[model samples]
Target: MLPRLNLRTSFQLAYRARFGWLATGSLVALLSTALLSAQFSGRQPATVALDTGLSVLRLLLSLVLVLMTQELLSREFDRRYFLNTLSYPHPRHSLLLGRFAAVAILTLGLLLLLAVALALLAWLIGQGYAQATPVALGSQYLVTIAFIGVDLLLLTAVASLLAVVASTPSFVLLGTFGFMLVARSFGAIVELLTRNTAVVTDAENYRSGIGLLGYLLPDLGALDVRMIALYGRMELLPADWPWLLLSCLVYTVGLLAMAVWALQRKHFA
Candidate 1:
């Protein structure tokens, strides 16, 4: 009950705090980018719109997540706001969980809004002319957006964990961004090293190093199903959706647990 109340209060506060400008700016950016891409794409307007819109969505949501996490969690601790928060008649973990929930909800709301608008824009752009390969604005597109949501949520977990563990507020942003960059690029790096082994010296050692790093980080690139959305390439999907979702769930839960543990022992002074 206490956690629930905290979650509600935190969510309301977060929404009232900065969500207005964030939502406005995100929508404007998404619409402008999609419109411009469609206008210049010539024949494949819908495909180009989806591609650009998705990229913009990913980038904007990532920035919002980092900023919100820093503001709600790290900055609160930095400014000693947590002192008053900790004085509440609730466990420390509840506060952390509540704030994290608020950020997650806000991030997801933004993602949904932008995704819907992008879909509508793509559909409108494609109405004039039909390309050879029409964009999949149906289930495939929704699935792609859903995977992007999962990826962002995973990063939210990472940010939450860093918020509790990092000594300084800036580290939260730096650490989360670092994690995101590495996780997103890990697959590409591995693939490059694999396909062009002969082009580089000590390719085997590089692969071994990257393979070990893969164990420590999630392969976020695998979550990008934009190609499937853009080309309606169902074959690009993973064989087992359940397993993929399970893996992401397990990772998210683990990250949240670590965050809870860290907050429980965090010194608020």
Candidate 2:
């Protein structure tokens, strides 16, 4: 029988499979340090070292989660292993759905673990820790996770689509990275453009509009919410949540549609 991946099963498999390997090793290592430091008393160590350590860990793992999603399609396509997936009785759409769902769940679990670890580390920081209301903390972390998810989903779409066209994982990774690195610099370009335009037009008027245009070129940096999450400024706006959710859904599904079309046309040698 084909796997019925609604919400629950998809999430469960994610945690059991990928999430554990990616997050657990790192978490455990950090936790071990925290435990060993229990007796040594110095606020600076936990505040600077522990807090920043866990934060960086979470960020890296989040990136890994996204990269892994891209590779899911890349590897199978590279090795001519799509046959195994096809043999299962599940359609390609269902398989893609399962892969996305599994990755989402893994990402989510890592988010939860990140929250708990950060929360504990913050509590231990004494004066360095800012007091946050429950709602504020929730909003901050939720946005962080959402930001990561949106970025990864977009990248996954690009990766899958690239594989469909390029037909090699190494080629796909290099091309995608090149395209993405160029796109990332657009924020600074937008800033420079804003400054120059202000002198010419007497306004920063369309600066944000230009920035919005950055969305088309793959704005993965936007998904990183650490600065906001830690600083307590950019909480998930009411509109932000729905926009990201909608964007991820549209991008992923649209790319997969393109992938399916490519696969149908592809002549496997």
Top TM-score model = 1
Instruction: State the local distance difference test value for candidate 1.
Output: 0.87
Which stretches in model 1 have alpha-carbon errors above 4 Å? none
TM, every model: 0.94, 0.64
Show the lowest summed lDDT stretch of 10 residues, model 1.
10-19
The TM-score of predicted model 1 comes to 0.94
Local distance difference test values of all predictions, in order: 0.87, 0.58
Candidate 2: 10-residue stretch with minimal lDDT: 127-136
Tens digit of per-residue lDDT, candidate 2, span 1-269: 35554345445544444655767676776666654553364433433444354445544554555455555656656777677656765666666556655555565566567657755765565334333321134566566656665665565566556766785666666765665565546666676776687554534655676677566665454455555554456643334656646765686678778877876677766
> lDDT for model 2, on a 0 to 1 scale?
0.58
